[model samples]
Target chain A: MNLQVVYCNHQTAELDIRERLAFATSDQLSNAYEYLRSHFPQTELVLLSTCNRVELYTAQESQDDAPSHQDIAHFFSDFHEIPLTDFFDDLLERTGPDAVRHLFQVVSSVDSMVLGEPQIVSQVKEAYRTATEYEACGPLTHALFQGAIRVSSRVRTETGLTEGRVSIASVAVGEFGKSIFDRFDDKTVLVIGAGEMAEETLRYLSNEGVRRINIVNRSPDRARALAERWPGAQVHAYEKLEELLVGADVIVSTTGSEKPIVSVGQFSRIRRNHLDKPVFILDLGAPRDFEPGIGQIDDGVFLYDIDDLETTCEQNRIARGTEVERALEIIDDETDRFMREIYHRATGPIVKRLREQWHDISQTEVRSLKSKLGHLGNDDLKAIERSMERLVNKLLHPPLEALKDEAREGTPHGLLDALKRLFHIKD
Target chain B: MVNVNVICFLASYSVVLIMELMRLLGRSPVRRTIMLLFGTAGFAAHTLYLMNRSNQANLPPLLSSSHDWLLVLAWISILMYLFLTTIDRNLAIGLFVIPLVLFLIAAAYFVSDSSMPVLNVSNLRDAQQAALRRWVMLHASLLVFGIAGVIVGLVLSLMYLVQHRRLKHKQTMQRGLRLPSLAVLSRWNWWAVIISVPLLTLGLATGFGVAFLSDEAVPVSMADPVIMIYGVAWAVMAAFFAWLLTTRRPAGKQVAWMTIWAFGFLLVTLVGLQVLAGSGLDSFHAGGTRDSSGLV
Candidate 1:
């Protein structure tokens, strides 16, 4: 048997190439699976396509029949309508153990651009499911994907790789926003400006059951666009910032202004009546839309700018980095276990036939001896049969032991062939 | 019966507290499980010790003596701690809770382990003893439960302060010491103060009732130093409770501080007076027929 993977990822290819090569939708992936199945009739295939990587894994029962690197490269060229020269150098290939290890790392998220990310596992699962739906998966791909899923689980629970939030928006909303409020469904979320960071923070808050969202921007069009994405969100005029701030339980500011938008003097005047109410402020702007001193005004205001989150994100990154070695060790151990199983699988049939041929020959000879000797007693015949069996086992033990040992490193194709020829075995 | 003593559980609790402190360095599931194992073993030993005392005196642990009362309070706190930590492995509640439990157990060491004098029904006629026993049970039970509430309030207040400081500084939560959200902590703290003050007040009222009832049978004086100190502590707690209820909207940090002061003062005063009473200071509540077991 043979295993191979030809792919390009964030590390090997630019975004331009990855995007062009990606099967962006299920329909596209189905079409690609159909095309690959028609071209390579004897191979099993699973295609894993995400924003950061595009990998095609194939397995075959015979090494001679497996598609070569050039064949897969040509398939990508013909299927995606891109010339082979455009990405031939960018497309990398791995065979056997390297192929298995690559899939394990990808499924475990060790190969993600954002290290310790959780999405790649689900992406790989979806790819495998799609391959199964298309009937492109056989025993080899099934075992490979199942083993990859198990390895991902082991890496996640055994290591602290996914323990902390590393992104600014995630840290701001997940760590700080959640610590201040018990629940967000009743709290008013105020977005000061329609920046990308604001939208991202809103996404996290929305997931946390936030229902009431108020978007205020100097530009009405941008604010409306932001408000339209959420079902219950409303766009407010920039003039109503102070009124909104008083009502908001959570405030996220990500304006592009060069200086502070809400000054201490202005906020203190507004915060006079709401001193007891807690407000989580995420000032994602570079210059900080909310003044720094407002945080010190009262215990109710939790103001965190980009620098604060960067420190947390950096710490989380370092923590995740430390777990990478442990994760790789797990992956390597799983990879070796998987290769060992596949190699032993290849030697199974030959070993079974060799043993069966020798035992059948011994049984037939023992029966012939009993029939030829008319004076032979029942005990004598039984003793002769036991001796014949022991002789056959003694003769077959050495080569069988060598075959078992050779199977540990990989499939011993040459030795299997020599055994078949020597024993006059068929198939 | 198995011989159980205060040292058995005290040593167990001390080890559990140290293990909880180790979480400041890093989180490990194995460490957490081990901490819980120690905490559970301590709670079991505490239960056995209390049962032995109750068996020796032939009374409930609460009504037996000051030492038994303090141990009952610690037992309740450890029960709460084990329940909370078991349900949520991430809560660093033990860091705030276990030390207070240890303090209560240690306070048991310095207080009188002999049964309360007013509860000594052995000398009275059977009819009068029955009547006195009911009054003492009410007084001791009310006081034990009320003190447990105060301990809970103190732990909640300390947790609120730590969580508030972490949020105010924008520091990431330690992985092992995950606390409740500030809103949840504040809400629970408010309830703790609200519920505990009323209980403590009723407990004081019941104490006065017991003293008045016992005047004819035994000269249970109202001017005992322990009683005087308890009355003063109750007064402080009542004032804080009133402020907490009547104020329009108090800051969370301010409430946390007030709870800490109110509850902290009451605990210290109660434990201090008991220690003084055990040292042979003049108090009707302390001295009685001492049990020979020395299990408290």
Candidate 2:
């Protein structure tokens, strides 16, 4: 038996090449599965296509039937209608244990662009499910994907890989924003600018169930465009910033202004009546949209700038990095155990057949001896039958031991063939 | 069949407090489980000890004696701590609550263990004694509940201060030390004060009413040191509660500080007077003589 994977990821290929190679839609993935099945009928296949990677895994019952790296490259070239010269060098392949380990790492999110992300496991599951729907998955691929899922779950539970938020926006909203307010559904969210980080923070806050969002930006068109993406979000004139800030329970500021937008004097005036009410301010701007003194204005005004969040993000990054080593160790151990199970599965039938055949011969001889020795007592006959069984086990031990040792390295086809001919074992 | 005593549960709680402290280092599931085990063991022993004391005094634990009263308060605190910790494994409530429990139990050791003489119904006739006993039970129950609220308010305020400090400094929440948001803590603390003061006020009113109606030639009076001290504590708490109600947009940190002071003074006065009364100081609620005050 053979296992293999042909893939290109963010680490190996540029985005342009990866985009050209990715199967963006389910219909495209189905067509690719159909094309691979037609081209290589004896092989099992699963295709995983995400924004960061495009991977194709194949398994075959015999080593000779598996597709080579160049064959898969040609298939990609012909299927995606790209010349082989364009992406052939970027595509990489792994076979046997290496292929199994790569799949484990990918499912565990160790190979993700964002380390410790939880999406890759579900993506891998979806890819396997799609392959099964297309009838492209077989026993070897089934065991491989199932084992990968189990290993991923183990790594998640046993390690702190997914403990803290790593991104600046996530840390701002999840780490600090969540700790200040119990619920966000009733709170008003004010977005000061249309910067990318501000949009990301808005997304995080929106997911936390912020219903009312007010976006105020220098450019009305950009603010309108940002408002359209999330439901219930309204665009406002920049002059209404103070009015909006007065009502907002959560504020995300990412304007590109050269200086602070809301200074101590301005915020203090707005905060006069709302001193007791808590307001979370995430100032993601580089030049500090909210002044540093504003956080100290009152107990309820929680103002966090980029520097504050980056420190937390860096700490989270370091924590996640430490857990990566532990996750990799788990993945490596799981891979070896999976490969050993596969090898044992390949040699199982022959071992069972050899034992059964030897036991049958010993039973037949015992029956003949019992019939011939009619004067022997029942106890003596039982003892003689046990001796015959022991003799058969002794004679079968050496060949079985050799086959067992050979199965450890891989499937022992050479030893199996020799045993079949020498012992007259049938298919 | 085994003997249960104050020392048994006190040692168990001490161990549990040490385990709760270890949480500051980091989170460990095994350690949390063991801490809970110790806490549960201590609570069970405490319950048994209270039951034994009630049986010995031939009364309910709440009205038995000063020692039993203090232990009952500690018992209630442990019950809350165990319940909260069980519901949310990550809450650092035990760090604040268990120390107060330990303090209450330690205070129980120094105070009077003898039953209140005025509440001893065996020496008096059936009808009037029954009325006095019922009033005393009401007084003790109200006082115990009010103090329990004070304990809750103290813990919540402490949590608010710590959470406020961590947020102001922009430090990430420590592992195993997760607290509720400041809003939740502050709101709960406000309720704690608002509810406890009224209960305490009614408790004091009932105590005075029972004292005046007593059939003794010399009824308990305002001049009694214990009653005077309790009156002063109640006044302070009432003043704080009135300020709390009237103030619009009171800062959470300010409220937290005020709650700590008001509740802290009341707790010290309540426990300190009892200890002094136990050490043979002349007061209305002291144990031993039949002429002593009956009200808690």
Candidate 3:
């Protein structure tokens, strides 16, 4: 049995390179599968495409026909209309046991951009289902994907890998925002900047059912563009910040300012319009756009800076680190077990043939002995037959034991061939 | 039948408090369940003890004696604590509220355990006794409810300050130690102080009103130093409550600290007066000695 994986992830390649290599949708993946079938018809494949990773896993019955690193890399180039030399260096290759271990790590979230994230397992599961839908997977890929999912579950159960909020946006919204407000849909979410970080956080908040999102930035065009991405979002001018502040229930600020933009006095004046209403201010800016004293101004104001989320993120990262080591240990054990099973399966036919051939020889000897000892008692004849069977087993024990031992590391192809010639075995 | 006492329930509440402290380190449903169990057991024993006191004294727990009255207040606080805790699973309210319950119960030990002379058959027949009992009931009920408000205000302010500190300082929440939002706590604190101060003032005013309506034979004095001290405490609280309500842009930290100081003084003054007056054996809150008391 031959298995292989060729992939690039957050660690091996940049985001642009991965995006260029990724299959964006199911149709793309399906077309890629059709292309793969035409090129390497003997191989079974599963394609895993996520924001951070693009991996192709393949398995083949015949080792000789297994797709090589260059072949799969060229397939990607031809399919995407990209030159091979552009990303060939970024593309990595793993085969046999390493490939299996890689898949296990990926599924377990040890290979993710955010270590110990729980999304990768579902991504892999979806990929496997898609492969099955496209008829790209077989028994080997099925067993592998199933085993990887099981390992992911075991890792989640046995470890603290998936415990805390891992991402900055997730930590901000989940750990801080949920604590501030019991519900989000009723609250007005004022996103104070239109940068990528702001957009990312807005995505998290929007997912929390934030119905009213007002994007306010120094640049109105950028604000409008950002607001257009989230559902039911409205864009406002930067000068209307105070009006929006009084109106908003939640504020997410991701301005890249060097100094404080909102002062304590400025907020104090803004708060006069809405004294009792609680406002959650997320200061995700570097050097903090909102002054620290603004949080101190009133009980209705709950202001959080990036440092708050970092502490939580750091603790989560540490927790995930310990779980990662544990997950790796589980992966190692599973990979070894999978390889051993495959090797043991490869040794099956040879062991069966050898056993059958020896049993035939023993039966023939027993028949001859029985014919020669026709005058002997029936009980004596049976005892003599048992002795002949024991003799044949003893004679065949050493070579069969050697063959079984050789199959532990991998399929004992050389030993099986030698045994077939020495025993006059066919097929 | 097993007899339950103050110590029985006080010990139970202490266990609940310890479990609440343990919850600050991390969340454990088992710990919360055990705390609830201890709280329920304690509240049950507390209820039985109050009933026993009332039975022995032939009066309600609030009118029996200062000791019983304080226990009744604690009992009310415990009920609130348990009810709030039952409703909000993630709230670390017990940590903030149980210490007050324990304080009231502990202070009961230092105060008078004596039942008043109002429970006597002879006093029950006296016309003056009926008038005095109404006044005393009004006085005690107003004080109990007012002090309940004070306890709530103090707790809400403390919660507000804690939540404010966590938010302003940008600290991640401690596992299992989550308070309500600052807005909720501040609003609750505002209402608590607003409603409770009036109840307390009415209690003090009624104390004087009762004294004025009584005949000279009762030997009660409105001008007594203890009563004057209570008047002073009431005035101080009245001023603080006025400042709290009138101020439009009260800073959260400022409000939290003021509530702490003002409510802290009110509680200390109220409890100190009871302890001191009860020690002297002649104050209105203390009507009889432990030797003359049926409930003790």
Give one digit per residue, the lDDT tens place, for model 3 in A17-107: 8888989977788789889999999999999999998899999878888999999999999999999988999899999899999999999
TM-score for each of the candidates: 0.89, 0.87, 0.64
Reproduced native contacts, each prediction: 0.73, 0.57, 0.25
Clashes of each: 0, 1, 0
- What is the per-residue lDDT of model 3 for residues B187-261, given as tens digits with 9 covering 90 to 100? 778889889999998998887766664535355766666677788878888888888778885756677788899
Q: After superposition, how far is residue A140 of candidate 2 from its true place, in Å?
A: 4.3
- Residues A255-321, candidate 1: write the lDDT tens digits: 9999999999988987888899888888999888888999998889888999999999998888889
Total clashes for model 2: 1
Candidate 3 stretches with Cα past 4 Å from truth are: A1-164, A173-192, A205-218, A231-283, A286-308, A319-427, B121-135, B205-217, B289-296
Per-chain TM-score (chain B), model 1: 0.95
Per-residue CA lDDT of candidate 1, range B91-200, in tens?
A: 89999998999898878887888887777645678877777788778887888888888888899889999999998888887767889988899899888888888888
Q: Supply the TM-score for candidate 3.
A: 0.64
- The residue pairs found clashing in candidate 2 are B284-B293
Better of 1 and 3 by TM-score: 1
The stretch of ten residues in a row with the least summed lDDT in candidate 1 chain A is A156-165
Off by over 4 Å in 2: A40-42, A95-98, A138-143, A332-351, A376-427, B3-19, B22-24, B48-60, B63-65, B118-121, B126-138, B202-222, B246-249, B283-296
